[model samples]
Target: MNTLVTGRRLARELGEWRSTGPAYRALADRIRVLLMDGRLASGTRIPAERELSGALGLSRTTVAAAYSKLRDDGYLASVRGSGSTLVLPGLERGDHAPGSGLPLDFTKAVTLAYPGVAAAYAAAIEQLPAYLAHDGFDMVGMPDLREAIAQSYRNRGLPTSAEQIMVTTGAQHALNLVTRSLYSPGERVLVEQPTYPHALDTFASVGARMLSFPVSQDGGWDLSEAQLQLRRAAPSMAFLMPDFHNPTGTSMTIPEREFLTAAATREGTVLIADETTALLDIDRGALPPLACFSPGVITLGSLGKIAWGGLRIGWIRASRDVLARILRNRPAQDLGTPLLEQLAATSLVRELPVLAASRSRDLKLRRDMLVQLLGEQLPEWDVAVPDGGLSLWINTGTMSTSALALAARSEGLGLVPGPRFGLDGAFERFLRLPFGHDVEQLRDAVKVLGRISSRVGPDPLRMPLQAVI
Candidate 1:
């Protein structure tokens, strides 16, 4: 019998292991993990049906079903005798996955640890069996976890209640659910230019019209332009990261927050305040959340940045009315976030002091290293040292980041171009470099990037920044 070695061979080389099981589920899960981990390069040819099924000890019919699902998910390509192959692009495991042996992965923004987490998780798991007798489908979330989240917000000066909280798969799912519930097709939404790149894609999928305002590295958002867009567009919803905004790391000023929220209130614009990165406040004495200023804001908070991305639990704090509407909309997307993860997050949340301490040390160390490295090696590049967060937004001014990324990729390095975060490719002159990796890994990536940057053409910011005001 043909080992069907070629398909299993190539796939296994990329870490797609085959499994023998009563159900094809084990094999299916293996395929999903490979894709999610990015081992399955998008557009790669897959193995033949007969080959894979036989090699993996699964029924041909089972293999066919698995392949069909993968195909539906854009993870595999189908052909005749050539068979299917792993082919999926970027995917999230909900929380941060610790770095494996990949050469370089500066694309993700995650730190090493928020310490004391293991202990908390262990305790939570130990406590989990006590409740395992009941079904763990916590769509609304656990009361204890909800209380912890609400308490955290209250500690930060935002009035929160367990009644207002709803746990989710992640901030991504939370955003999707909020958009679906509150906004309509053809309704307008506003985001920062060069915002969280993936969010634009997610929001766009729901047919939300997008308007972006420029926010500078010095951290000034175009208030006038934003107000104009809100008034003219009368957007039904808006997503703001008032704290440690993505890409540029711009935080909204108290004045800006007050003015914007007042206008949004007048126009009845529902604000999606993504506080996901806000907890990463290295400033120690950072201002209160924008949600504190506006009752209309539906704040989204997650454990991914502060604790671990793998925790896969985020919550939204909204009015009772909005909560009811969101609850109604929940069934279409997901049945509920897994009860186990909720338990994990709850355990983590209660242990914030220990987690926050470790995260602070970890992020501060990485940030310092990146700043020193960038200053010493890539001085020509305009890089901002953000107050908090796992990444750096470096201005390669007027350079083609796409070309730079391609060159780096060829050198066994991975990077996402700035335009990936911009609509109509606005930030082609910039790039977001995550220092959220092992120090050794980050240093290596910077070295490779230094080489790539050197080979590239002259930078447009060659002219001195006339005023760093």
Candidate 2:
């Protein structure tokens, strides 16, 4: 079924859309920005021109011109009776399209493979022969791998057993499995305002009605608002990243975690915590896992950031009952986690602390270097240096980050706009710049951005938001 965005809703999402352009162009640009930001899903039926014009208190001619501009830009397709439908160029909805052959892609916050990954793979191949005697379709995961994952939790001060674990291909796959198993269509789901973009895609893919509270750079998680929403909306599930949060790079305090856990318990909301970036700590030290405060919390962990992106190993630490529920629905999504990957993961888990130390050292150097470069090159921008996490969340101050992104694209730099990280087109001025690249690459990207910033106006060229890898 095609999703429809009513005129009133679209107007609400427009959120002070005016920019330095003609009314029609500004309107069209805002719509295009919204589409690229994932605020407007591809294949969604847009409101009719007249309906939108009335809703925004604009003339029909202006709305018609805006629609015409959007159609010309390949963002909308018009049908006679049915209204215009949003479309991304050269691809359909749910398709995984690569970046625009750009030399530097800042859309992903991942680094290259860890140095120990190759040896781990070799170890996995050696261990694989022993497992070949039995059928390789592993739905629940191997006992050894599960135990390793459980031990990781135990080391973190959270007591987890093997039965409470379910391994998947990656953190993304784990999130998908958990969301599909736990959430029903049309159910309310709460999330951080600026979260992992792909996580937003996950919730949206499930037809979830999302509610959000702000995750500010200075204020951190808005506990008061979250509590109010939990009590008022009573959402079924709340997805969160309490440690080294994506985009924001801020973690919640222990008191905040306990408060949220208590509130969610009272509201019957299950907290699904993504700890994919939990161990990416640089100097902030460890905070207790969100699950430590509540048994109902479901935590997702991954080796993508710490070990290697290509390794493709992640697991869910939930109750035994929740693991069973996920297992029952697993086959429809995938046959099982790969045997070789699990074996490699097992080896990597044991080497985590060493890998983490190495990773932290490298990350600290790159992060500090990137921060210095950005600060020197772009002094006007408000760049926050996070203690840990993959990226620096920047407030572009006077410069529209979306515009900066568009301008940077001409210089062969790919970036995810701020709105892509949040719901309903928020965070337009913010940008997530990952320092997971070589210092040279980081320097070049920042120099390009600084150069482009001066040339591009506030109304940057609107482009599609790439599916985060």
Candidate 3:
């Protein structure tokens, strides 16, 4: 079945899309960005021109012109009886690949593997033979791995048990299981305003009605708004990243964490805290995990960031009852996490402190290098230095990152526009630049940004394509 995007939803997604250029051209550009960023599925049917015109308060001719422009660029396909459908030229329908096939792909916020990962895998292989005789289908993690994961939490001052841990393929998979188990058809899910885009995708997959609260780099999480939403909406689940938030890279203050957890408890909202990037600490010391504040908070942790992205090991730390619910629903999606990966994960989890120390040294060096390069090249841009995490959240002031990303692609650079992290087309002027690359790559990326920064100004649509490319 083809997904149909409503006119109102389209308008919301096209937030602040107007530029100094013609409205038709601006609309077409925004739609293209949405399709390129995987915000809008290619095979989905968009609203009719007249319906979209009504939604945007524009004339039908303007909407028709925009649709015509999209068609001319091979982004929209219209049929006589069927509605206009979005399409990516030269790519199959629903083919939203991760990178742009460009050099310097900064779309993902990940880091180089910890140097000790290979040795850990080797160690896991030595121990794997003993467990080879079993069925090896591990829905709830290996006993040793679960205890190690639980002990890692206990090391952080949070009491946890192997009984509370259910291993999964990765943090994203764990989130899928959590959402499928907890979220009903129409229940609202509250999330950070600018959060992990894949988390938004996971929630949307279940047809969830999502509400948002802000988490700014300057002011941190908006607890006031979070409390308001919790009280008013009474959402079933609230997804959070209190430690080293993905795009923003801001960790919540102890007071902020306490307040939010207390508020969620009051409203009976289940807190789903994603600690995927929790241990990516640079300067920031250990703060208590969100699970410490509330027993109901379901925390998701993975080795993908700390150890290596290839290590598909993540676990859900929730109450035993919640684990039971997730376990019951787990078989519908996936059977078990790979046993070899689990064995490797157990070794890594035990050596997490050593891995974290190594990552911290490397990340700090790269983070400082990227910040210095950006300071030298793009001095006008506001770049906040995060204490930890893989990326830097930048405020490009008036520049539309969607337009900037389009221009960057021509320069052999890949960038994720800010709106990809936001809801309702927010954060168009913001950008998340991952600083996990080498010093040379960082220097080249900055040079590319510096070269195109002036070209992609406040009015991205008005920028001459010939000049940018």
Candidate 4:
């Protein structure tokens, strides 16, 4: 179904609207920024010029001029009687708005394949002959791979058994399976304010109503508020990324984990912890996995970050009952995990610690380099140096990151803007910059960002909204 932004809603999203340029240009630019940031999703219907003008207390002429600017810029289309519809430039061509087959892609936080990945594949092929006698199709996962995954959890101070694991093609595949199996239509799902974008996509696809709490780079999780929401909303489930928590890169403290676990158990809310980036550690020492705090917590683990994303193997660690429920629903989406991928994942799991150490050393170097480049080039922007995780969550003070992202596209750069991580048009001034690229690529990205930052200028509504002078 297509989204239609009402006049009142768009007016609220537009905020203060005024900028250094002409009013019409500013209005059009803001709309373009919103579209770029994913706050105003593609294919959404824009209000008629006269209706928007009336809503914002502007003349129809000004609104018409704004619409004309957007149309000329390839951001809007109008029909005689059907009204205007929003269009993202590259998306109309069936490509991503940014990084659609682009050479320099920063939209993904993953890095190049690990050095040992090739060896694992070779070993998997050698081990393949033993399973040739049986039918290749398997749904629950191969026995060896499940045992390896379970042992990994045991190493992490959490007890596990092979019966508690179910392998999937990737972490995303696992998340989708879990969401579909557990959530009912219109049920409330709790999430962080600026969580992973694709996770938000999965939740929305299920028609789940979302409630959020803030997770700041400095302050970490707002546990008090999270507890309040748990008590008040009584959501069906709470999706969390507790370890190096996605864009923010802040892991939950041990006490915070225990506190949250207790709260969830009391409220009867199921907590799903995404540990995809859990092993991507730099200087942050080990923290207890959220599942260790409570048996009810369902954990998602993946080798995508620690090894190679192309390996495409992940698992869900849940109680036997939940695992059984997930297995029953699994075939509706996929027949089974690939035999070749499972063999490779088993081989990789045995060497997990060695691979993780190698990845950590490489990530630390890249993180330091990226931080230095951003500090020297774009000093005005507030950047948090995350101890773990692959990205930096930047606070672009007084500047609209959505505008910066739009401008970067002209330079052949791809960026996922801040609002992509939040709901209801929040995080417009924030951006996630991944440090998983090569040093040279990071340098080039910083240069492009520095150039674009100056052109993007300050956000008009940086301060509280008040009566215009």
Residue pairs in clash, model 1: 45-85, 46-84, 46-85, 47-83, 47-84, 48-83, 95-309, 95-310, 96-309, 96-310
Comparing 3 and 4 on lDDT, the stronger one: 3
Task: List TM-scores for all candidates, in order.
Answer: 0.77, 0.91, 0.94, 0.91
Where does model 2 exceed 4 Å of error? 79-81, 92-100, 457-469
Ranking by TM-score: 3, 4, 2, 1
Error of 3 at 73 (Å): 3.4
Least well predicted 10-residue stretch by lDDT in candidate 4 = 460-469
Residues 3-103 of candidate 4: C-alpha lDDT, one tens digit per residue: 77889989977765567779999889878877765667878899888789989999999999999999998899877877788888888568744566665
Cα lDDT tens digits, model 2, 1-469, are: 6899999989877755666668898788777767765667778999887899999999999999999999998989988987789987766444323234578878789887889999999989998889889989899889999998899889989998999999899999999999999999778999998889788889888889889887877888898999999999999999999999998889999888999999999999999999999999999998899999999999999999999999889999999989889988988899998999999899899878888888899999999999999889888888888989999998875556655665676688888777678766677777899998878889889989878877865444333332121
Each model's total of backbone clashes: 10, 0, 0, 0
> Which pairs in model 3 have colliding backbones?
none
Candidate 3: C-alpha lDDT = 0.89
User: What is candidate 1's lDDT per residue for 1-469, written digit by digit as tens?
Assistant: 1112255554343221222232455455555543443333344565666876666666799878877777786667666665565654443443323123247866677666566557667777788888889877767889999999989888878888999999888888888888888887778889877678657867776878898777777757778888988888898887788887886666888998998899889888888888888877665446888888888899988898888787788888888889899999899988998877777788788877667667767778888898898888888788888887668888876565655665576676767666556654456567888877888987888888788876755543354322121
Clashes of 2: 0
As for model 4, its CA RMSD to the true structure in angstroms is 3.2
RMSD of each: 12.0, 4.0, 3.8, 3.2
Residue-level lDDT of model 3, residues 140-222, one tens digit each, is: 99999999999999999999988999988999999999999989998999999899999999999999999999998888998
Q: List the residue pairs that clash in candidate 4.
A: none
Model 4's TM-score against the true structure: 0.91
Residue pairs with backbone overlap in model 2: none
